[model samples]
Target: MSDRVELELGDLQGGILSAYGKRGFPFGRFLLFHVNHPAAGRRFLEGLRPLVTAALRWPEDVPKPAATLNLAFTFWGLVALEVPTRTLRSMPEAFIDGMAARAAILGDDVGRNLMHHWDPVWQVAPGRPRVHILVMLNAAADREGRPVPELEQLTRLVLALAGQSEGGVVLMEGHAGADPRFQELAALFAENPDGTRTPLPTEHFGFVDAIGDPVFDGQYPGRQEWAKCIGQGAVDGQGNWRPLRTGEFILGWPDEGQEVATMGLPLDFSRNGTFFAYRKLHQDVAAWDTWVAARAAELARLWALPSLEAATATLKAKMAGRWEDGTPLVRAPDWESWQAARDRLATASRAERLAFLTAFTFADDPDGRCCPKTAHTRRANPRDMLDPWYRDPDPRARRGSILNDRRRILRRGLPYGHRDDPSGEHGIVLLAYCADLSRQFEFVQQQWMGYGLDFDAGNDMCPIVGAHGPDAKFVIPAPREGQPPFIATRLPHFVSTRGGDYFFQPSMTALRMIAQGMVDPT
Candidate 1:
């Protein structure tokens, strides 16, 4: 709202803005398509703009209105659309080449290390296009564990609309589920023998998942504080640090770079749009459990703990930088402290809640004493940890890096697979949105997550999620000085890249441009 940061929510796609906010819609489906008939696809793409949600339409309330269903239209599918080839070339090369190419470019440390390297569905032939467009349908789920009938109706409505464009055909469809192997873990985290479920969200990993997500402006009025903590807020040493510049996530506006994004060949076609990387990540629950279970007992004996289970929980928190319950280690530091924070949060003031979760920086604890430098959260954001260092070496510049601005990505998507199917095909469907894949998403995946020089932990991948191989180890500093560090070694691949593709989520305006055959580069 300030004169300096004018974000046009109305101009941006709602899905690109706040579509996944407010704990996200309970039930959703992913539809993948390959453009078969370009003309038809154009019509389809154009028709979709009218149906797409706008950021301005986000409900002001906690829970969205009943029967509320939203759609985000993005493309790998666009390549298959009837647009001219030159237009495709004009787009980001990563978007044109897709995630497989991007992954290959990211090298062995990141992409090749992915479990999906062996996935049958993920064996995408080099240069052979896979998924083209990603149609995300998010709807509220009923207590009966059924997709709301209204959502089904909404699906039919969208399908009918898609019928208007012959630009593409269905390539595949993916839904959220947990493998059968996930049952025990799900029960441990969230389940009852009565066979019923609670609304309390828990990922297949059985940890309180999906915490401390960055909230952009236009999504919520109170997210300014949340944004700043993530490197989006104030760059200057004055004023309230707000959420990252809107352009950092959404295209068209100024980004954390303080520059307007030059999207694709035709600027208008790319404006208000963002790029999304769709990843079907398969979680190896059994492997992750085996590793942790072995360590938890050793830790219990070392700490003289009464229960191995509690020790396991602590190790998990240390691995993820948060307890399975979503309490952050940076704030809680230990089980007792984590619980205290959790209890307080039940009635904590707004300031208390924000500070409890969003507040905290690595500046003071640069040593990874409290929250290990190699923790998943630290790798993903780095907070003030990566403050720009090179230009002037001024204390502030050395602490915060504008490069962090270019690296921040907006995460979306939900878990796929059934909860009780242990060894079942349960995993998370991740949507990483950013203006540039190589700079933002790929950089984080490679530099920060896979390689640890950024954390001063040299060559150490993320202990929990990174591509850890045999003899791999995660060092959790001892709680008190002089105490030895707890090392969890021989970590198995907990999550594998099952299947993925990159697509462009264009602005509604761009969708219309594509549909109307108006994508002239000149």
Candidate 2:
């Protein structure tokens, strides 16, 4: 019995496969809420369902609709609403204990990672329960207008629904996304001539963001990119060439192991649902500029480069594993080659650019010379780069992209705050989706981004987003074997987490059960 018929595309929400894809919106916010009344909450949740975006098929000619809204519940939130005890017990321990429970496993510092930080607006102080549900609203913007109207209407609708019900409380959580004071900060990562609808623009760091996301079941209609994006998901005598299985990301489907995932005992309730990690990352622009300027100059002198700016840019690319424009080092190993790729990409169509941008892999550049093994991109995605990092036991697992296949995350986030303010509130609001938070999202954060054991560079960390206290180093050996290696140490923090939590986006069927009070223990 295939789960597809049981959990059809229409059963899921659009946010699962849409973010950063063709359906991606320019603006969005996560309105975190809590249940004030359990009895009334059941009624309220059912009412809110009408507003949730369904897995509707999008056509090529018609632009995918904007002003999308989705709902995600936390373990505490569900408990607050009096979920069936038997059902809760069936859930994985990881989901019921909440994201904080997995903090230790994720190797996060209690204070630094804010594994326990609550929303400051609530003044709940430390060690208190945070909000339960997250109302994710997404929309696009034009030069003259942002998507504030759609978001405002949707927010008001949620409040109105709660007003009549005795169960839920609309949280007044203050987020930078809705506040006017951070308007400049809001548009920080946005394109020029603000509020205009643009497709996945670069972040304040002055580089393109969100590329090479995993390709899944072609949910977004009239799109061929998703199928082609996998870059040969399989392997043969020639090389690997196949897309990852859809089940690896979406629940109730066969994963890379060729087995369907089990979402607790009642497969009907959790089949089409997935997990999410919402992070508010604050970028330190001033620190990055100051540190990079000095380091690039030093590199120029050591490598006998042309100028400080040139060397600095190259050094930045080395750290990120891609050129500022999003070209991978494997495709263009040197500054000169990268510049040529950049120029050619400029004239290509958007479709051509996106395909070209993510087409390359580490199969050819196994050595760190082309793209450093510890580089941010290589560490984060790896993509047929590592030599059996996970425990496979079987010798046959020594090769291919199976090691990092399940680790892929569907990145669906936008930049927040404006670059206008050097010290102002600005950075990316990262929203990543995966079937297993422990294996995918948290794994990348701990093993790949924060540390460097997988790359064989010792404890060396990702230069761009690694949280290694105040002092850290990013070492790059000279492109030529004999030249002196360039070492950039004492990398002041370029990014930090403000506050965030994990969420469980349930299927529409599960939502109906909760609303009708049909969730009693089986």
lDDT of 1 by residue, 379-486 (tens): 887766665542343544454546665687877766666645565577777778888887888888889877889887888888866766676788888877767788
- For each candidate in turn, the TM-score is 0.85, 0.88
lDDT against true structure, model 2: 0.70
lDDT of 2 by residue, 1-522 (tens): 112222365688877766623464667765667777877777777888887886665653334665777888887777777777777777666677665566565544533455343335322346654677777777766554466477667767877886786435656454544462121113332345654544446788888777767775544343453445545243321344555667767778778788887765477667788888777777888888888888888888888877776787798899999888888888887778888888898899987887678876676665588888889888878876664422344535546656688788888777776666544577887778888787788889888887788887888778988876655787786788888777788987677676666777888887777667776454
TM-score of 2: 0.88
> What TM-score does prediction 1 earn?
0.85
The weakest ten consecutive residues by lDDT in model 1 span 179-188
For lDDT, the strongest prediction is 2
lDDT of each: 0.64, 0.70
